[model samples]
Structure formats: C-alpha cells, structure tokens
Target: MSLPRQSISPLRQRMLEDMTLRKLSDKTQSAYVRAVRGFAGYLRRPPDTASAEDLRRYQLHLVETGVSPMSVNAAITGLKFFFEVTVERADALAKMSPVRVPHRLPVVLSREEVARLIECAGNDKYRAALSVAYGAGLRTSEVVGLKIGDIDSQRMVLRVDQGKGHRDRFAMLSPVLLQTLRVWWRTAHAQGKLLDGGWLFPGMNRVNPLTPRQLNRAIHAAAQAAGIDKRVSMHTLRHSFATHLLEQKVDIRVIQVLLGHKKLETTALYAQVATEILRQVISPLEGLPPG
Candidate 1:
C-alpha cells in the first residue's frame, strides 16, 4: 500500500512564494512558516482569517505561556509579514507590537578554558571546528558553511560566503588556525572523508556539511569533559574571541569588521565583558586626593 500524500495549503504556498520573491534565506523562510503555523494552531482556523483582536489575544497567549521576548518578537514579525505582505491585511496587526528583548552580556570563556574545551572535543574534526569558531570569530553557521576553497593560505584569510544578512565577507585566518585546519584536512583526506573543494567539516556520511545542531552537541560534550560550569555554546567561543581581542587593545572598529557586525555599538558591547580591559582602568576614586 502507498502512503498518503500530504499537500501544502494554498495559503502557505502563497506565503512561501512571497518569501522566495523577497529572497529571504531558507532559515528565515522556515521560521516565518513556523510562526504562522503556530498562530494557526492557536487560532484553530486559517491565519488569513485572523482579526486585530485575535492577533492581540494570540500575543497575550504567547506572553502568558512564558515565551521568550526574542521569540515573541520573532513571532510578531512573522505574523506581520503574513498579514501585510501575503494576505494584504495589515489592519489585523494594528494592536500587535513586538516585545522588548532584554539586553544581556554574552558569556565568554577564559583562554585557558577555551584551550581545555578544544582539547576535550571528541575527535579531530570537532577540535578543529571549535578552533575555527574561536580563532576566526565565526558564527557556527559560518564555520559549518566553510568549504576547502574558502581558505586562502596565501592571503591569510578565510572567505565567508553569504553570512548573516546574506552578505559575503572575509574573516581572519590565523597561522595557528590554518595549521589546525591543515592537520584536520590531511587526516580526513587520508581516510577519504573529504572531497575536492568540498565542505571543510563534513558529516559522518561525508556528503552533507556538518550542521549547527551537530556542532552544538560537540561543544556541549567538550565543555562537560573540560569541567566548565559556565553555560557554553558555539557563540560563547565567538564572544570570547571578540572580548579577548578587545582586552589586547584591538580597536573596536577593527573587531566590528572582523565579526561582520554592521554597527559599531553592537561591537562595543564586548567592552562591557572584557575583564582585562576593565582591570586596566584607573577608578575615579583612585585619582581623587585623600580627604
């Protein structure tokens, strides 16, 4: 017997087309679809039929259910797109507003902790991957998306194609990191796990690139093995990278460029967590004369 076929709803199809026309990334398209689907699940009807009051109530429900402010804001943006762009019913979003996300400092690991974490990774592949995340200050997605050709040993840079915001940029390729990658490449090549100009970090099958989820799991395992108590993720390495650079007296603008951040203020946030920089500061009280 043949399995039954699942069909896409016309509404969803239309939304997908709209997203594609706007050149939204696949990740973003998926998030928008999920947001609309969640709203439909709550409404018990088609999202297109949602009214202004219904939208308000749905947001209230999300808040009452303890959804994070960032997630709630994401949901709001998705719903706004659905109504304003897909269904042409912008009026329905009149009462809906995005929640204010609280600003929190990013968690960073000490240099020693980072060393221990990398050493504890399960295998060479993960160890090298984690090193790239810290050494080059790349996001997890950028690390996994790397290909053999993206590395420019001659130029001493790594080409990041289509990073966040769908923009292409180059990241630093430290001599140390280049060596780590070369070692990993030689090992994987000897095992016939690498293809010509293929993914730098391939999955078990060697066909697909290593996914963010897999990398995340590896970092968690490595952190546990290293006896690190602070909450750690792939981004933690990135935060540490920027913070360490700031502590070493690198210009904030330079760090901003290296991190591919658009705003200087966004990169300035690292100043708040750079303990070494803070230690170097002379307190105002210290400059004051004794009474």
Candidate 2:
C-alpha cells in the first residue's frame, strides 16, 4: 500500500509544534501563523523559501501601504519568530527590523462613565460580565476564561489564571462584584448550565467560553447606550480600573499587581492619564495675574 499523504503541510505542523513547545500564547501563535501566511502570499511561495532580501522587501511594502509602525513592528516580530524559531532561518530574520512604537497614554473612562456603561448593558449576564471586567480590571480573555473554581467566596478573592505572559494572580472580590457573580451563577446553575467545571461565561454551544468578539460587542453597545463615546473596548474597562484606583490614592505597586503588569512602569502609565491627579495640580501659569 502507498504511504498516506499528510493533510497539513509539514512546515506548518512543525511551526505549530514549535510554538506549543515554547508555550507561546494562542494569540501569539495565531499572529505568527498569519504573519507567515502574509509573507508567503507576498512572495507567492512557502514562508520557508523567503530570503533576507524578500523579508526586507516585505517590510518596505508594509510601510509603503501606510500600515501603522506599531502594527508593522508586530508583524515583523511575528515573522521573526516564524522564521528564526520555527523555520530555523536566523539569517533571514536579520534584515527584518521592528519600528519604534511612539509612547501614548492609554484611554481611560471616568468612574461615572464606567458605572453608566456597566449599568447600560442590555441584560444581567452582560452587565455582570462587564462589571467584573471593570470591578476587577480583568482582561477580556481573563474575564471570559474564568472558571467557577477561580472564585474564592470565602477568601474574597478572584483567581486569574494564565493571564498575559501566562502568569497567575489574584484580584480583590468586592462585595458588589461577588453579589453580581452569585446572581449570574445561580441563574446559570438553575438552568442546568455550569457543566463539568465549565467557563463562567459559556458561549452559545456551552462548551467553549464566550468569544472576545461577543464581549467587545457588548462593551460597544453599552458605551453607545450610555451615550459615552471614547473609543471604548473591553480593555478600556481595565484602563479605567487602574486609573480610578490610582485616583483613589491606591499605590502604584498595588495597581501593578492587580493589573498583572510585569513592569512597574507599565502600571505607572496610568498616572499620566489620571484626571484627578491633574485636577489637583496648580499650574505655574496660575501665578500670572490676570493674563
């Protein structure tokens, strides 16, 4: 009998296995795959066939197409990983360089806006989800990936597992957040859901958790319903959480731990966007009399 042909290309399979071995996040793995596919599409050949010149030309093409430097940089990083790590082609990656990202403060909603937005969620389930997002500063993935076991009612803490960089941490479980979660949990359980240590916010099929797209849409709808337009997303709740806490005189270190930021400077960025801090400042211009 003839040997069977593999459905997946050998290169692609190996790349995936390499990423899995390194324990790269699925998001990062997908980005790397997409970057490799884009490269292949550009050259009309397999990514393995890309030479250093081809990589340079692709970088030029990206910039010429008016792609943001940050996006271009991310694509370059992905391509670097796919070629250097997956394809064992370090020389090909040398010609590809990342663009510098300009520093910008994160967008943050005021405390009142956060409250109104959460209140405007169309239903209890969405409302509770959004509340947890803001109340605990959990990322969209973290919020949707929550398991029932992650909630420590007795300890008054929320367990966040495998957050950014695959790190685990704990967030405070405020009485209000705990109450809202209990309500949603009771309803879900009464309806014969929450099966087999299922996702706290199960998706339609009830096997997978709610997708990020759905969570993003809910946030957008809530922002619109609340009549607040600030380019908000699920992550905006996280920004608001940190900013609001900073405004409340919470320590930057505490906020850093809560947001699961690896660097204190990352948490310190919120200070730049905290309006309360700005409001308390007396400008030197105030010294100019009646200008």
Candidate 3:
C-alpha cells in the first residue's frame, strides 16, 4: 500500500523549506509565496502540475492582461525558484525569461528642497526620522527599524543591523542629527515610550516600531507642505544623500560602503545626478580660445 498523502503538497512544503534554508528576507519570502499563489490561481490547479507549455501560456496571459513588466518578472522569478531549486525540475522551466526593465536615474532633491521637506514634518519625531533618512541615507524600513540603543553618541555612529542582504553596517551620524535625536529622545523619554530600550520612532502602538505606510504618508504630507513638485519618497532622500556626497567630492567607493551596495557600479550611478560636480567641471567649450 502507498504511504498516506498529506493535505499540503510536499512540493510546496519543500519550496518553503528551501527558501528558509537560504535565509531569504521576510519580504522576499512573502513576495515569492504570493507569486506562486497567483500562478496557482491562474492555472486553477496545483502549480506542481504545470507543464512547460502551461508556464509559457501563463506568461503570455500576464502580458496580454497588461500586468506591469516588473510584476510579471517577479512572478516568473518565484516560479523559477520553486521549480529549479525546490522541485528540482530546472529543465522543465528552462524557457522562463525575465522582463528587461529600463534603467532610470534616481530622483535627487536639492539641498534647499530637502531642508524645506524636513522643516514641514510638523512634529519633532517625524523631523528626526526625516533627518535620519537624508542624513544617513537609510531606506524606509531601516529608518523605522531603528532602536534607541543603535545611536552611539560618543562614537557618533548609528549601528544598522540586518540591513539588505542581512549585513550589518555603521552609518555616520552628523552633529546636527545627533542634536535632533537628542531632542526627539528627550520627548519620547518623557512620554514613557522609552522608559526601557525600544524603537527610536514608535508607532501608534508603542510596543512595535512605526509602520512603513505611516512613515511614507508623513513624508508625502511633508512634501505637499513644502510645495515641491517632483515626486519624492523616503528613497528619494537616500538618492539625494548619495548625490549630495558625490557633489561634495566624497569618493564613490566610500558611498558604496555607506549604502551597503554589493557592486561599485550601483553606487557610481549617483555621479550622473551630482549636479554640483557637473557644474564645477571646466567645460571643453570654455577651454577653447575665441574661435
């Protein structure tokens, strides 16, 4: 007699185990799960039973249905990982392809614009949070994940734990930012939010850290108040930080370490947006004597 089968498929269980073994981030794991679920829902059956033709057809359907290329690519990546790594059927999914996304320069706010944005934060907590984003070039998640103890006042360094790729790095803390944090800390401490060590910027529920959505909304509202036209977000602050540093003549290699970029090329992109650097360079036209 055959051994009893479980309600959950062995294939899916193994896929989850594979992801966990690889130590993927929680966000990445969630995205993979959602992508696989979408595939299964599209097929109206178990994803394990998908044939090569079925995969191609589903991909075509996604494009025909006007799904964004980035999203389509994410779904494809999930399926590829599930089949190639988890199910060990790499040959069957060999035809899978990723969408080629166009490269675009990141948005960089002017120093004045960044100042206005921070000034419009309304409250000291948000002001300090915005300052950290621009001052340290941190991601939204990283900014929200900050703990009170991460600030090293004496050494003037902020310890970032489990950043992207699960790597730890120290970001520079400016004198101005230190003062801002001190004020924010004083307020939080008085409110009993930081009686013990906790989130530097707590959410409505002080037990947990502030949510990304709320932080994003605060940034948006501040931008609106500042009367800036270009679309800006927490990421824009990071981009501006890199570009501003490049403008200041800071080496690209150093920026790479601060941003935790795996590749130097990734950090070099900021050179294109370093407006001040472009301005200061002697134009070849200026070098030429009157023609």
Q: Give per-residue lDDT, candidate 3, residue 168.
A: 92
True-structure lDDT of candidate 2:
0.88
Query: Where is model 1 more than 4 Å wrong at Cα?
Result: 1-5
What are the runs in model 2 whose C-alpha is more than 4 Å off?
1-7, 287-291
| Tens-digit lDDT string for candidate 2 (1-291) | 111347457888888888889988778888877788788889998888888999999999999999999889888988888877887889997788888878877889887898899999977779889999999999999999898889999999999998888889998889999999999889888887677677888887788888999999999999999999789999999999999999999999999998999999888888998899889999999888895
| Best-fitting candidate, scored by TM-score | 1
In candidate 3 the C-alpha lDDT for residue 38 amounts to 92
In angstroms, give how far residue 65 of model 2 lies from its true place.
1.3
Please report the TM-score between candidate 1 and the true structure: 0.97
TM-score of each: 0.97, 0.93, 0.93
lDDT of 1 by residue, 80-101 (tens): 8999999999999999998989
Number of backbone clashes in candidate 2: 0
Which digits, one per residue and each the tens of the lDDT, describe model 3 over residues 1-291?
A: 112356446766777779889988778877887888899999999888888888988889998999988999999988888888887777767666887877888989999999999999979999999999999999998999999999999999899989888889999899999999999999988888763678999998889999989989999999999999898999999999999999989989999999989999999999999989998889898989887
Clashing pairs in 2: none
Inter-residue clash pairs, candidate 1: none
How would the candidate models be sorted by TM-score, starting from the highest?
1, 3, 2
lDDT of 1 at 113: 100
